[model samples]
Target: MLTHLSIKNFAIVRLLDIEFSSHSTAITGETGAGKSISIDALGLCLGERAESNMVRKGADKAEVTATFSVKENQSAQAWLQAQDLEDEDHLCIIRRVVSKEGRSRAWINGIPATLQQLKAFGALIVNIHGQHAHQELLKPESQRAMLDESGHHDAILANVKKQSHEYNKLLKHLQSLLNEEQQRIDRKQLLQYQLQELDEFELGIDEFPHLEAEFKKLSHSQALLEDSQICLFNLYESEQGTALSIVDDALDKLSELVEHDPTLSAVTTLLSEAQINIQEAAEELRHYVERLEIDPLRMQQTENRYGKAMELARKHTVMPEMLAAHHQALKEEHAALEQQDNDLASMNENLDILKSSYFESAAKLHSARVKVANKLSKQVTEQLHKMNMPHATFSIEVVSNGEEKINSHGTDEVRFLLAANKGIEADSIEKVASGGELSRIGLALQVLTNKQSATLMFDEVDVGISGATASVVGQLLRDLGERNQVICVTHLPQVAAKAHQQMLVTKFSDKDITETHMQPLSQEQRIEELARLLAGDKITDSALENAKGLLQIQQENLI
Candidate 1:
């Protein structure tokens, strides 16, 4: 519920601070006294768009703050928690500021917030029904929305929307596959040929590198054999004292001197070990040289195989090392292409299933909407009777278009039908009712459908209504306030008298500055305000008496 509102430097309202009750409150004033200005300022706190003109003539900026107590507003509380903006005291303060340059900012519970966030929270907590809201009944979308809201068809509507999305997705997928059918077949044949050619080669991951190494050795066999023979001769068989014979002579000299000096004995041991190592090395070299014979046939065969591998690599536009990976990719692509027909069949079946699912949900949604429409029509018609239209008939017409494709909100087209007189047949509200009748119908519908505890603000709801009917409208608002808060801006004394709380808006001028002010009314003050509403520009004795009597009746009803 809205607990308090503060508006500063907004339009002609310099500063206004007011507290609200949990019941109905009426705002009353003379024409041009700025009664609707309060509602306009409150709208800013509800995230409504603001213009530079909304700021007072000389003020730098305008600001409005609305405070709501959320102890019983579970949805609001949940939203607050979800946004991480919840306060420990369960109070929500929405503040909006607009500079003279048309710049605006908003905060939720002291944390900076986007305008969208503010609007989202506002929708959950308050509904401001302007004088023009009644005209929206002529719109088909609005009519459909009312039916759904009245029926509490959230779950069914969700299912319908989900099914519609799934159906469209499958349809698009199936179309794409069908469009690509011939192209996929051609691709499959090309890939099959490529894979056949690659498979005939029977390539291995490391075979290219090994084959190249063996080819180099076979091609240079004669040169390699000549070099190894020169190395063997230098190590053991050269006529100018080969390394082995020289080491043997040095060992003999050291052995003879070993008894004379201990250092010579160590030298003799080193020389003998060197001779043994040299002899072993010569024998291994000889064996290696013996294995180095050239074979012309093997060399030619190795060169031919290596050259073929290189030619295939260049044809495929890949390095020899990458040939194996490229072949594997072709194999996978061929396999996938071979399965396209089966996949297409499966998708077609899935699309059929999705289409059926959508229609089923659409039918259930239509049924639920029809049931709710019937109940709402009866309820609203009864309400219209109480609003002084005894012969008025109201109905909801739900027609299923049964189009081949579904829409986001299902296939039902809804319209509101109304008959304003006894002998008149019910017809579309757009063609039958005047502006005044439309407002009353809207009021009746709101009173019947609004079961949530949100505060309802009505601006000029009593327009074109007066006399006994005005009193009935007042009573309806009072009753509505029993379970929710109602703030109404009205010119009718009957409506003002019925308010549990009353505020009077007055305009005054000082020198060159004209300002508007609002003040809560005491009992005597309310009597004066109602008297003013009863008698335009003058309060007579009879008007005062009537105001008092109306107040008394309202008091009794409250008790």
Candidate 2:
């Protein structure tokens, strides 16, 4: 429901602000008045395709903003949440600015929105129809979508659609494997070669560091042996008293004194332990000095093995430490290839199951739609009777063209059919001959599909309609307004009479500027405006009387 519209520099509108009600609003004015201009500005704010021509003649740009009451629009609220937009209760503001240079900018709830986002939200908020058929009527998908909306099957269709896609994706991988069996066989051969190369030269994670440490020790063997031999000679075999032999001589002398003094016994025990430690150190040093032989061939062999391992590491694009993991990978790949055929067969079976599952789900959804279509046709027919469209047959039929098959939406083609008079063959709603007939059909669709509290705008809906038929259109509009807001730009006084509020769109021209303005009618103003609509350009006493009587009748209806 649109709460307000503010437009500036849009055509001859210049600046216009209008507040709306939750009831029927009929806007009437002279032929060149700004009613249509107001609609165009509102359309721009609704994210319609815009052009630089929309900008007023000397103005650099045009801006249009609409504030809507959208408390019931859950989908729109969800969209706003995703875009991080502010939603204050139910009010959503959409604004668009079109420059004279042809660039256009848009906003949603004060947060900037792309033209695409504005367009999407616009579809849910308002349905505007005028002298021309809606552009969405051209596409079969749009047609099907509208029909699904008529069926009220969005939630069920959404679930079925999601499950179907999951089932399809789940099955596609295995089917691909089944179809690539020959390729898998070739892949298996490559894996076998890699496996053999890795297995023949097994490597361990810690082996390289261990071997390198050992090699380093062996390379420095001569220097290490010399250092050890010199230290041993200084401690036990040097002329400075051969420390180990001195300890041994002291122990021998202390033993002799122990027989005479008890303190000498303790000194003799300590000297004996020192002599034993010196003997062990001398024996280790002598062995190291004897075995310190550098074998060049062994050193060369170790260097070659290290180089080979490093080269292999570089070849495999991994460090030498990862060789064990590389070997394991080759083993796994070889095993996988060995069982490739069985895996492929399993994949094929799974794909088949998925295909079957999707088809079953789709078929069930299609059946549900068929039932919904018949119900919709009957309900619409029942509604037509109230609109004085007795004997006016209506239907929604499904027709498949073996096309438009994608995995997302199910595969059923549907279209609306209509017949305006008795004994007439029902045909596409677009094929109706009379503008009045089209008006009534459009009215019926709008009334039947009033699932939301959205604002429905009709520009010149009462065109080519008058007499009792025009009165019926007015009644229909009024009833539509009872549940949802109806804003119609009408020429007929009968239609205008039904409005809970009437607005007069008038032109105000000046020497420098010619502009259009709209104002809600004061009580006396309504009488004059209705008279103008009733009697055309000239005012007469009988026309005023008729306009006043119409107002009185409408007032009574309100009572």
Candidate 3:
């Protein structure tokens, strides 16, 4: 329940602090006295949109803070704990600040919070019914929503919504696949042909480079043999003066000289080593000449293989060395495309299953709504009789033919019907009800259907009601206050007289500034305010007595 509200420099309110009662509280003021300003300030604290125009003149910013007791509100407490914003005192304090530049900021329990978080948390604790709430009640969607809210249909409704979402998602995918079916077929066929060609080529890793090397050797075999023979003749097997023979002759000369001088021994040793190296070279050359051969057949075969590799590389728009890698990539793509085809084949079955699940849940939701709607109609009719509509007949029509297109809210159409007189057929409420009648019906629905919030606020919802009916509305709110905190802003004296507590809004203006002030009324003060409401600005003795009598009657009824 809302415990306190502090507003600063907001609209006509300069600085106002209001401590609310746990039961019914009435806010009253004369015309243009800014009675709704407090409600607007509270709305800001609850994350409503703020504008620079809402700031008081010459003020830099406007600020509002609302405090709520959460000891009994487990949902709010859980939300606070989840956000790490819970206080040790079990109180939720929400604050909002709007600057003159139209910028806004909010805090939950002194911790910085986003506007969306404030809205979500605020919804758990407060439900505010605006003056024009009946306008929304006229909408068919709102009617359906109200019917659903009256019952415990959350689980079934959630299942239906989930199945509908999945069904739509899959349907969209299937449609897209069907639209591009020809393209997919063409792509698959192309991939298959390319893969087959690469598979038949039978390329092996490192085989291309080795084949090139062997082909080079075979193509130039004759040149290689002739050059090797020439090298052997020059080095060791020359006919004029073989290098081996020359070295032997030099060694013999050096050997004789070395006996006289030891320095010549180094020369003789070098000549002997040279003669051995020349002989080894000549032997190796002889072996090469023996083994060397020209084979046209093997060379032709190698040439053909190399040419085919190059042709394939050019055809595939890749280098010869990258052909193997490209082949693997094509195979992978073809496999994925085949998988997509398989999925397409089974998509319809999946969609049908989802559709069946959605229909079943929606049917359950429709059945639940029918039961709730019957109870709601009976309760609302009883409430209307209490609000001076003695002969009013109210009913909620829930109809589903099972042939309507699937939607998140099931297939049922919910309509609120009303008949103002006895023996009259009830028609759609929007078409047959007057403004006052609509307000009464809208109020009845609001009072009965709103059971989730800890605090319920009615901002001038009794606009078109007065006299006995206004008194009944006040009593209904007072009854609701027994279970939930109720705040009502009204101009009706009867309504104001019925509240356990009353606050009066008075506007003061001078040449430079205008400000609104709100204060809880004392017993005498309440009498005076109620008198003013009953008899205009002039409060007569009789009006005071009437106000006192009204308060006395409400007190006796409470007992």
Candidate 3 C-alpha lDDT tens digits along 391-507: 999999999869467777888998999999999999998899888898889888888888655698888988788899998988888888887888999999988888889999999
- TM-score of model 1 (CA atoms): 0.83
Task: Please give the clash total of every predicted structure, in order.
Answer: 0, 0, 0
lDDT of 3 at 425: 92
Weakest 10 consecutive residues of candidate 1 by summed lDDT: 445-454
Local distance difference test, each candidate? 0.87, 0.79, 0.88
Between candidates 1 and 2, name the one with more favorable TM-score: 1
**Residue 160 error for model 1, in Å?**
1.7
Instruction: Please identify which of the two predictions, 2 or 3, would achieve the higher TM-score against the true structure.
Output: 3
Q: What is the TM-score of each candidate against the true structure?
A: 0.83, 0.72, 0.87
Output the number of the TM-score-best candidate: 3
By summed lDDT, the worst window of 10 consecutive residues in model 3 runs over 445-454
Clashes of 3: 0
After superposition on all CA atoms, what RMSD does each candidate show versus the true structure?
4.2, 7.4, 4.1
Score candidate 1 by lDDT.
0.87
**Deviation of model 1 at 189, angstroms:** 4.3
